[model samples]
Target: MLIELKNVKKYYRTGKLNVKALDGVDLSVEGGEFLAIMGPSGSGKSTLLNIIGCLDKPTEGEYILNGKNVERLNDDELSEIRNNYIGFVFQTFHLLPEYDALFNVEIPLIYRGISARERKERAEAALEAVGLKERMKHKPLELSGGEQQRVAIARALVQEPLLILADEPTGALDSKTGNSIMELFCRLNEEKNLTIILVTHDEKMARYGKRVVHILDGRIESITLN
Candidate 1:
């Protein structure tokens, strides 16, 4: 399994009240699987994503990424795991408007202290993978919604991470542009064997994945394999 979660629980303490965002959830994601998580607001969908991505720790139970238990890792170790093993794509592009596409893609490599020449070369390769090689010098603001999202995808690819976690990746684009983005995801999954976990409210968007998981009231309602 690429990911394994056993009876995971995430609780939030707000003053005198305790809210359970995730209530004893158990899940697993196999390597090279394209999975989509769907849910209504407050369903703990995002919380689950955060936990799986190693961005947040579970309040209880075990979170094992690949063969290692994340609950045993310290903050610095977890950060290292996130940088070296996982890639994230957000709804809002999240690209720095001031930086060119190449520079933006180099940010993750910079954190890892990769040499400047290697970073540029790898970033260019990633952009080429996304068919944005010619747009490497353009800033985020200069690209269209679809192009900007492609740049974000390239940035994620630059790390060559084990998994990609995308939170509503197409929410900011129009229908046509969103379809293009989702299609790109499908192509990447087939061509690169990239393990992808995406969160979206759109059923059409969810269909792009091989399996769809539905969440409700902080619990998994169903899992449908397409």
Candidate 2:
């Protein structure tokens, strides 16, 4: 299993009241699986994604990622897991506006202490895989919304992570563009055998996945094969 969450709960203390973001949620994802997480706003889908991505810790329960118990790892260990095993794509293309596509994609490799030559090679390959090789020198401001999202995808790909977490990846794009992005994700899953878990509220987007997991009230409401 690429991911496993058992009885996970996340609660926040807002002043005196407690906000339950995830209430005893359990989910399992396998390698090469493309899963969609769908729910209305405030449904805790994002929280589940965050915890799976190692961005947040659960208030209770165990999270096993790639056979390792995440709850047993320290902060630095978790950071290493995130850097070496997981990749992320956000709804907003968070590429640096000042940098070109190549450099933006190279940032993650830089953090890994990879040499400049290897970084450029891997980043360029990733960009080409996403059909952005021609725009590698363009700044974020010069690219279209879809192109920016492609760059973000390339950044995620540069890590060659076993698991990719996408949070509303196509939320800002038009229907056509969003479909293209979803198609790209499908292709990646089919070609590379990578595990992909994406969170979205759109029914159309959720349909692109091989399986759809519906979340509500911070729990897994249902799971269906698409």
Candidate 3:
């Protein structure tokens, strides 16, 4: 299994009042599987994605990524896991407007302290994979919505992460552009064997995945196989 969550619970203390962000959520994902999580706003969907992506820790639960327990890792180790093992794609393409596509995609590799030549090579390859090789020199402002999202995908890919956590990846685009983004995800899952976990409120977006997990009130309401 690529991911395993056993009785996960996340709580927030706000002036003596406890907010149950996630309530005993249990989930698992096998390698190479495309899983979609669907829920309304404030449904703990983002919380689940954050935990899975190593961006946040559950207040109580066992989260095993690959074979290692998440709680057992310290801050630095957790950072390494996020850098080396997990890639994130958000609704808004968080690219630096000043940097070109190639440079933006190279950011993660730069953080890893990789050699400049190798970073360029890998970044270029990732952009090529996303069909953005021709736009390598273009900045975020120069690209369209779909192109910007593709750049975000390439940035996520630059690390060759074991898992990709996408939160409303197509939310900012039009329906046609969103479909194209989803199709790109399908290609990555099928052709590259990338294990993807996507969070979306759109049922049409959820249907693109191999399996769909429905969330409500910080708990899983149901799961369906596509």
Candidate 4:
């Protein structure tokens, strides 16, 4: 299994009241699987994605990622796991406005202390993979919404991560653009065998996944195969 969450629970104490974000959620994902998590606002789908991406720790239960127990890892270890094994794409295209597409995609490798030459090479390859090679020098402000999202996707792919966690990646795009972005994800999942777990509220988007997991009240309501 690429990811295994057993009886995972996440709680937040707001003043005195406790908020349960995830309640006894258990999920398993194999490598190369395209899974979509569907839920409305406040459904804990984002929180679940956060935990799986190593951005947050569960309040209770075990999270095994790539055969390693994530709950037992220290902060630095967790950071390493996130940097080396996981890539994240958000609804907002969080690209640096000042930088061009190439530089934006090179940001992750820069943190890893990769050499400039290698970073450029990998970033170029990733951009090409996402059909953004022609716009490598375009700044976020100069690109369209879909193009900016493509840049974000390229940034995520530049690291060649084992898993990609996308939180409503196409939320900001129009229907046509959104479908194109989803098509790109499908191509990556099929061609590169990259494991992807996407979170979206749209049924149309969820159907693109091989399996759909419905979450509600901080828990998985159902799992359906596409």
**Pairs of residues clashing in candidate 3:** none
Q: How well is each residue in 1-226 modelled by candidate 2, as lDDT tens digits?
A: 7788999999999999999999999888989999999999999989999999999999999999989999899999999999999899999999999999999999999999999999999999999999999999999999999999999999999999998899999999999999999999999999998889999999999999999999998988999999
* Residue 37 accuracy (lDDT) in model 2: 97
What digit string (tens of lDDT, one per residue) describes model 3 on residues 1-226? Answer: 8899999999989998988989999999999999999999989999999999888999999999999999999999999999999989999999999999999999999999999999999999999999999999999999999999999999999999999999999999999999999999999999999999999999999999999999998999999999
lDDT value, candidate 3, whole model: 0.96
Error of 3 at 105 (Å): 0.3
Per residue, candidate 4 scores C-alpha lDDT tens digits across 146-199 of 999999999999999999999999999999999999999999999999999999
For all predicted structures, in order, the TM-scores are: 0.97, 0.99, 0.98, 0.99
lDDT at position 77, candidate 1:
90
- Clash count for each candidate, listed in order shown: 0, 0, 0, 0
Candidate 4: C-alpha RMSD to true structure equals 0.6
In Å, residue 54's CA in model 1 sits off its true spot by 0.9
